[model samples]
Target: MPSITINGRPAEFEEGQSILEVALAQEQEIPHYCWHPGLSVVANCRICLAEIWAPNPRNEGKLEPMPKLMPTCQTMAQDGQVVYTDSPKAVANQRSVMELLLINHPVDCPVCDQAGECYLQDYAYRYGRASSRFEEEKIKQPKKDIGEHVLLYGDRCIMCTRCVRFTREVTGTEELMVQGRGATEEIDVFPGKGLDNELSGNVVDLCPVGALLDKDFLFAQRVWFMTKTPSIDGITASGDNISVEHNNGTVFRLKPRPNASINKWWISDEIRYGWKFIHDESRHVMPMLRSRDEWPSPKAAEAWTASMEAATKGLKSDGRLAMMVSPMLSCEDAWHLGQMALSIDPQAVIGVGPVPFNGEDKSFPGGYTVRAEKAPNARGVRRVLSALGIDVLDAVGMEKALSSNTSIDRVILTGNYPSEWVTPSFADAVGQERFLLLIDTLPNSLTSRADVFLPGATWMEKAGTFENVDGILQSFEQAIEPVDYCKSEAQIAMDLQSALSGQKPTVFNAAATRQAMASQAALDRFVSDVTLPKVPQTVESDMSIIEL
Candidate 1:
């Protein structure tokens, strides 16, 4: 490995790595706006300029200084290279760049959406001077609604060209371009096209300043007040890592977490905006049990004893129970539900629920993908069932069994799909004759027909693993508590198990359940193969406050 000294700190680097990349790896501060690891390096942001010194071959290996400062982003690291980013010359250049960038920038920090997380705000505080030198009027540009999900504020843009490069090099749509010259330059859409690509929302994330903003989250909440939870994409099988940012139990936005193997630095607009269903008013918030006369109670309960008792009224070892596990469930949820069904009747029919698909998989030039399969855990459900020594049936097979299997008189169905997933044929298959126990997150025809219905939690409200289409197991943490009166499917399954066995109910723990699954010979991989998202650490400052 080649070694370099950056600002008195020595670090090792691999060949072809740039000074900015190495500095970032070492956790050193190098103020930058235009450089992103996933995008091409244009080095237009002069804030990362650093003085360089290299060993001279002709002068008996003596250190030789370069004539001028270099852009750390574009300069590759060399062996025995010395870089100074905090020297007087470098600091002067940084102050100058910050001063220039702020000349036309509006003083909208109090009203800007990116106030706390804006790189411009951070650099301005660190590198800017006390007052402005310019006496002329600041240029003011109007905000433009560029696309369905993105808004462009021309005056705030420092012309880093990140958005322009993303459209041309990543999506290959070429919808965004730089218009006009020098100080008056601005980003604009093509004549007949808008920034309406499937990945257009990413421009908002790529913007280092408030120039680009998400239309859906424009004035929703301040960044500093929200808590970000590491989570995986639940709407698709792409398994893109993401951060669920929320405040007061309300999710404000979903931003991509960098995963080199999965979604690198960008997530599709569908995944970014697909979390609205989690807080929709139509979600089920109470457990209900139909009376003998077929009327359901309107109130919810902390202990759903009546619903559990109704679900297990006639369940016996007669092998008359069939379970349909939805693809929207986590692997731990599916496993617990499956074990409970088998405990009631050893020969119970366990099958995976309906998996939704739309069109074909769409691939982008930047290596990001949009999957056709809308469900997140179909593969995980199938894997758990297979490990339990059960031959799982597909969605069609389960529907057919429900229609033809006259012997099955009790059914346990779990549905956590984001939208309405019930069909007339499927409803008719599980006819009114049999006992239907449904655990679901949303209202549909089945909720009305179920003999006992329990409100279930969404993926965001639960902690568990999901297997993607590629058979990769990824785990996510619970972002927020379950919506009022709603419980996780895993907890519902455990409660039913306790009710049937006349034992005390145990609290469901995702990690402990996974360890129990790993105890089985076929599922031992669950302990080792599941990929957990990295938890960010909070660094406390050493500075103490004094009362004035």
Candidate 2:
């Protein structure tokens, strides 16, 4: 262990830790812009300048200050070394640096999207003078559309080079570069080239100031008006951690939540822009049922209740039953669905549903990847079925079994896929069953043929744990309420189970359901002594990448 004194306060740190790292760990404030934990430190942002002290050149027993100020982010802490982050000398140097950065910055916080959480605003308040001393005209640079999702406000940039470094080091696209020199310096993309990398949305999150902005969320909402709910992106099997930003029941955007073990400081464009489906107008919001005449029944509570009763009758039969567990569901929801199937018929066939696989895994230079497997919980679904001693089947296997086995009269299918996954052949084959019940979040090719359709909630509307491809189970909380009249899978499952038991069904309690699932033998592996890292706080800070 090594120790150092920062601003008259003793702080302990590791041997190779820097003064900025020690200060931030102790909740001490040290203004910075160019340094990021996930990127190489260039020390271009001189805002973190601090006075350093070491053993005197003439006398080894005495301490003396270094003649020049050093960047705290690049300077490693030594035993007995004394550093001053806010001393008179350090403050004077930082204020001068801040003044230089603001000489060209426009005073337009009212129209800026990053006004509430902008680092430049905070730093200017702390280290800048009340008024600018420069009497010359300010430089004005035109805004440029550098990428499909990124817009650059040249005047707002302080030449921190965070965005340029992100594309070069993390994405390896090299689409961004610094143009011009001195007062005319600005970030620009190569001609005929835009930042279309799979990880391009990360630059917006990496930007400490308002220079880099997301085109999708430009002027959408103020940061202070929205609340962030921690969750994981269900668009891919990676289960990358995320935060859903919404205001007044509307999701404005999705940003990566810093999880050092999983996603680290960046998230792919899929996770960043995949929340649009939540607001799609074509979502299946109301429950529907097919009458004896093969026509959809009119919408009403009676229709919904009648459909539930019909589904219960189908499940409470002596005939063979089949349940298709979707990878889009959490382990807790899948477990409940499987239990209800077996309770009706001990020999019920249970298997995983369709898994969407696109191109091969697209990996970046920084080790971030977008998996080809689009499903979020396939491994989790398999774990549940394996624990229940049920044989897993694919779409082909389930269709073949249903069509050939006359004894398989009842079937339960669920899917929340972003795209159409049910083939016409499979849907037509499953339509032959005596009772066909479909549970889904959106309408698809198979919905029209289902005897009963239950509108299920999306991953954003429910709370549960999902096991990634590597079998790491992580929990996520519900972000927003279910869209329109949709009901959660847990709630629907609970109601159906109660109806089967000849008792009253109550509303779903996610916490209680998760607690009850802890005792299940199938879920024991996921919850047994497995501890996930705590999610970082959602409050925006003066700095984005504090770890150095």
Candidate 3:
């Protein structure tokens, strides 16, 4: 294999990779801007300039130095090449470039939303001069409301052109472009058009500085104070890897985690802003039971215990019970629910709940997609039912069965959808005569008819696996605690199972549940094929503080 020497360190490289790419791959520091792996290379940011020495075959393979410093982002790596990013000449270029880029940058890090994560601040501190050399007044640009989800702080932009290129090449909207030349240059939208593309929120993530900001996330919380948890896209079947940034149990934003085979480096605005429903005030937060007259009984510990006992009482293998597992639940949750139902009655009817759809799947020029199927785990729920040797039914099939099967006197239904999913026809199919036990996160028409209503948790409050549209099994960790008095669907299932057996309920562990599922011959893939999220390592600072 061919290798290149970067800053005296030898590293192997593949053909056609840039010198900057090699440096990054080898953990060598090379300050850069205007160059993103997902965007085109403009080579406008000159901070990555490096001195290069390569072998010359014409001169008997002697090493010859390039005449001037080269842009590492555009310079392809060559075998037997020697690169210097820490030499006198390269360091001087870096200082000059950093100083130039910071000339017009505002001194607003104290108030900027990107203060903690801004690349400009980091590079300026490391590669720039201690003080400014310019005496003239700095150029000031006004903030613009460019799109519904994005705001542009023109004064903070260093003209990296990352946002401009994303709109032109990836989204193909061409709404953003450079409006001026030289020091007065600024990014602006077309005269009549706005940056309202379906994926417009991605511009905020692409900006290296605080130029592009998310309107919804602006002034919400500082990046340093938030905890970022790796999670999957719970609203769509695309299963885009995401970092859920939250502070004090409140989610502030969702950023795309780069998965080349899936969502790449971008996520749709729908997924970015769809998490608002998780904190809605109308969420079901407490368990409720219906009295003899069909009115909600007062909340009490005894009432809750009685509701759980009655929900699973009078158990026999009579095939008189039906359980509708929701697609919104995790694969582990679905499996546990299925096992609990089967334990109570061997011939119980198990079917998948309703799967929601909006429009056809939409694709972007950059290969990112938004799935029409809103539910995340429909395929997973179906897989669990199939493994249990039960025939799975769709929404229509479940409705028909509920209406046709006269022996099904007890039904257990789960719904954790973000919106109202109960339709009049489906509601009528369940009817008012039978005992209906509902585990849901939101209120709907069925909540009024349910004999026992248990508040369930959302995906953010649970740790489990979801199978995407492409049959990829991905796992996510819990980002926050469940809302008050709300338990995860898996916990609810476990509690019911324990109540039926007259034993104390144990804590629900998704990993343990998956391991138990893998014990089955037909469901062994849960252990081998599920892809867990990579846990990031934390390195403590070694520098000792000197007290003055």
Candidate 4:
């Protein structure tokens, strides 16, 4: 490894690594803009200028500091490289650059959506002069709606060309471009088409200034006011990394949380804007048990116990029990459900629910992909069932087991899909012989026919891990409490098990459950306290790694 001296601190670097990259890896301060790991480096913005030292040609063998500052972003680190980010010359240059960037920037911090988390504000306070030198009229540029979800304020741009490079190099759409040069330079989309790619919202996150904004999250909430919880996107089996940003139990937005092994620095638009369903008011909120002559009470605990009694009353000691666990459930929930079923009948037929699929996997030029499989934890459900010594069945096999064998009398179904998963034909296939129990987050046609309907919790309202498409077990935290009367799938499973054993039902604790199951082969590597990789904030670095 090559070594570089930055601001009097020695740091090792890989071959061909730049000075800016090495400095950031060591958490050293070096102010920069126009450099993002996910995009190409234009080096147009001169904010990262730093003094460089090298052997002088004029002197025989003495080292001399370069008079002209070098852009640290474009300067490769050599074995004996010496870079000074805090030298008198470098400090003066940084201050001057900050002043220049703010010359035309409007003082609209009160109205800016990115005010609290804006890097420009942080750098200006640290490296800029107290007073302005410009007395002339400032340039004013009109804001433009460049895309369906992207809005652009031309004046706030520093011509870093990151957004432009993303469309060209990453998405390969080439929708955005630099329309002008120098003082009049601005970001614009091609005419007759907008920046509406499947991965367009990432530009707002890429912007260091308040130039680009997400239309959906334009004025939702301040960054400081919202609590961020690490989560996995439920849109696809890929399980792209994300952070659920909410305030007072209301989710305001979903943003990418970098995971070097999964999603890296970007996520698809589905992951960015697919959280609206979590807040829908029409979702089922209360557990209910449908008796032959009357309706059960709405009380969660009482209804939970009654539902379990009704569901198990029709079950026989023979292998007559069937369970369909949805792939949307976390591994812990699925495992608990399997355990509850096996406790009732050792040879119970357990299977995964219907998995939704759209078109084939769509691959982008930059190596990002949106998988065709829509479920988040199919691998997880299978792994859980296999660990419990239960032979799993698919939708077809489950139907066959019910239809071919007239002895199968009890059925339990669990799901939290974004769309209609239970069709009329699916209900027709089950026939009228078996009593049905349903656990779901939304109200579908299947709810009306179920003997026991248990309101289930969404992924946002629970904390657990999912084995993604790649079989990597990634954990997510609860963003908010379960909606009115709803209990988590794990909790519901625990309650059901308690009712069978004539024990009082208790709420499930995810951390404790994970610890208990730590010895299982399926969850051998499960970690409950997983967090997103750190987003370096010090400055000066551009290293892109897209693990799509």
Error of 2 at 493 (Å): 1.0
* Alpha carbon lDDT at 204, candidate 2: 90
Among these predicted structures, which one has the highest TM-score? 1
Query: lDDT score of model 4?
Result: 0.81
lDDT (0-100) at residue 475 of candidate 2?
79
Q: Per-residue alpha-carbon lDDT of model 2 for 124-195, expressed as tens digits?
A: 898888889988999999998888899998889989999899989988999999999989988999899998
Which runs of model 1 end up more than 4 angstroms from their true locations?
A: 292-299, 314-319, 539-548
Whole-model lDDT, candidate 1?
0.89
Write model 4 residue lDDT over 1-548, tens digit each, in one string. Answer: 66879888999999877788899998787888888766667787788888988666578646777779999998888766688888898899988988888888886888899897887888888888889999989899899999889999987887778888889988899999988777777789888889978999988998988999999988888887888887887758987888888888889998888766778788888878876777787787776666542334455566655666776565434548888999999888987899889888888889998888889988788778878898899988888888888889998788778678777778889988876788776787677757888899877887877878888888989988777777777777888888777788888888778777778877677666677676776566665433433443553434576899
Model 1 Cα lDDT, one tens digit per residue, 1-548: 78999999998999899999999999998999999898999999899999999999999989999899999999999989899999999999999999999999996998899898899888888888878999899988889889999999888998999999999888999999999988888899888788989999999999999999999998999997889999999989888999999888889999999998888899999999988888888776777766532223444452376677777674643648999999999999988998998788878888998899999999999998889999999999998988888889988898899999999999989998888888899999999988888899878998878888888999889899999888889999999999887899999989889988999999999999999999988888789999998878875644597899
TM-scores of the models, in the order given: 0.97, 0.93, 0.96, 0.91
Q: After superposition, how far is residue 370 of candidate 4 from its true place, in Å?
A: 1.2
After superposition, the stretches of candidate 2 with alpha carbons farther than 4 Å from their true spots are 56-58, 292-303, 529-548
Error of model 1, residue 207, in angstroms: 0.3
Q: Model 2: how far is 360 from its true place, Å? A: 1.6
Lowest lDDT block of 10, candidate 1? 293-302
Better of 1 and 4 by TM-score: 1
